[model samples]
Target: MISTQKSFEKKEQGSLYLVPTPIGNLDDMTFRAIQILKEVDYIASEDTRNTQKLLNHFDISTSQLSYHEHNTNERTPQLIEKMLNGQSVAQVSDAGMPSISDPGVELVKAAIESGITVVPLPGPNAALTALIASGLTPQPFYFYGFLPRKKKDLVASLVDLNKREETLVFYESPHRIKQVVEQMVIVFGAERQIVLAREVTKRFEEFVRGTAPDVLEWLENEQIRGEFVLIVEGNSDIEEEAPQSWESLSLKDHVEELMENQDLPSKKAIKEVAQLRGLQKREVYAAYHEINE
Candidate 1:
């Protein structure tokens, strides 16, 4: 299971470089990212047209192929084959790092399985960029890239995250920004401090800092624009609780204990037990219902 990759060493297979693009400002693009894009035999881009603009701006003509979410399954094997055939590739998203709230994870995994070197060139990222300037504790921050769209799922996710002491970061579209903050006020309480960084690293870059309710009030009066990074202060007054260990319990007992302790339904408890034990949900479901049915 252990594998070592010498990124710069000469090898038979070509390297698959993970190149990061600027979130907004073009000047933020690193020199090595540009060089990799130009030198690579192919550039697998999330949006070929959007990446073409960046390439054109830099005056680098690299042949590109579409590699977005829609076409990930179809293109992953093809890209892997190219790298295995000794053709280097550079994977990039529309902005920021590839596979960060973007497509390219499957291709990267396939490339690694086929012994292709993946060299990641770091550059612009909206999460860390916003976190540093949000006037919140920057270290030990949790980056939860976009929240679930469904109201039920969103609240459930926030309910779990509200217990952490580290700062939380999230990405939200302009359309959902208002609704997300409204829910945050409910789950995280109106008094908790939060920062909204909109249009980060762009011409109209702005940060709105205050309690959750204050930011919600500001949003109600203003026209929200551009992408947003929501930075929330962690739960400082969270009560310390003993960790629940399932070592002594059987798999079925573990499921029952979760249902009884957490007040979760049988299905949800079984799923939780499966996740906690790293077993398949189907496996846990069967074990929890040995004689039934």
Candidate 2:
């Protein structure tokens, strides 16, 4: 590994700062974030009008240039050029961290490739804010910002992610929450636990925790509004399930499916498993037959 110690030295070029804004309640805004916004030469805002209200509240006079999804291709290079000219810039999304389910990641990636210093200021985030209070295992959580919207892609994503053991977090919209939860019930099974945090940090903020079926039932019953952050409980028995991934099937399940469907014998299935996963025959045999004895 090529390692380089970054001495706390000053760079002659301007730095790109990723400043996090409040998710909902404005009181969650940090002092340092406000100071950085004030100090920066220009602000790259996801929405200039939305950010203007924030700046007005904090008494910051930094000029904003729109940098959103529709205009990112044209605007990213311009922002990079501004920073390259030794002008410090702060990028802020509509809410929460700039790149979490928002724009600015492309700009951040471009800035880093150009060796520009990228500074991230800590502040409010909807996912973590929901996860910590979700009453689920907090450590080793997987933050998947948003899921694929299409039916096939969404199924494929859930199939791949269902086998993970870490707590899973996802940002979802209000309109699709019901259908998403319903799909989750189908893909992840009904017994899997989940924490549904809605309108987080807002006046109508609410968290509903239960199994997949339970939450699905709740969504069916309630009047859904605002955005959502889904904290899903991962597979409880991960070690056994992790060694091999054959379309979300266990090594043994894959072997069994092959045997049942393709009319292969136990030995043939085990050999196929070895060939496919690069596992020793004996190891496959052990996992398949539960040969712990």
Clash number for each model: 0, 0
Per-residue lDDT tens digits for candidate 2, residues 109-188, read 89988778888889999999999999999989999988898988988999889889999999999888888888899988
Query: lDDT (CA) for every model shown?
Result: 0.93, 0.90
lDDT of 1 by residue, 1-293 (tens): 79998889999888899999999999999888888888999999999999999999999998999999998888999998888889999999999989999998898889888888999998899999999999999989999999999999999999999999999999999999999999999999978999999999999999999999999999999998999999999989898876678878998999899899999999999998889888989988988899553
Best by TM-score: 1
Could you estimate the TM-score for every candidate? 0.83, 0.80
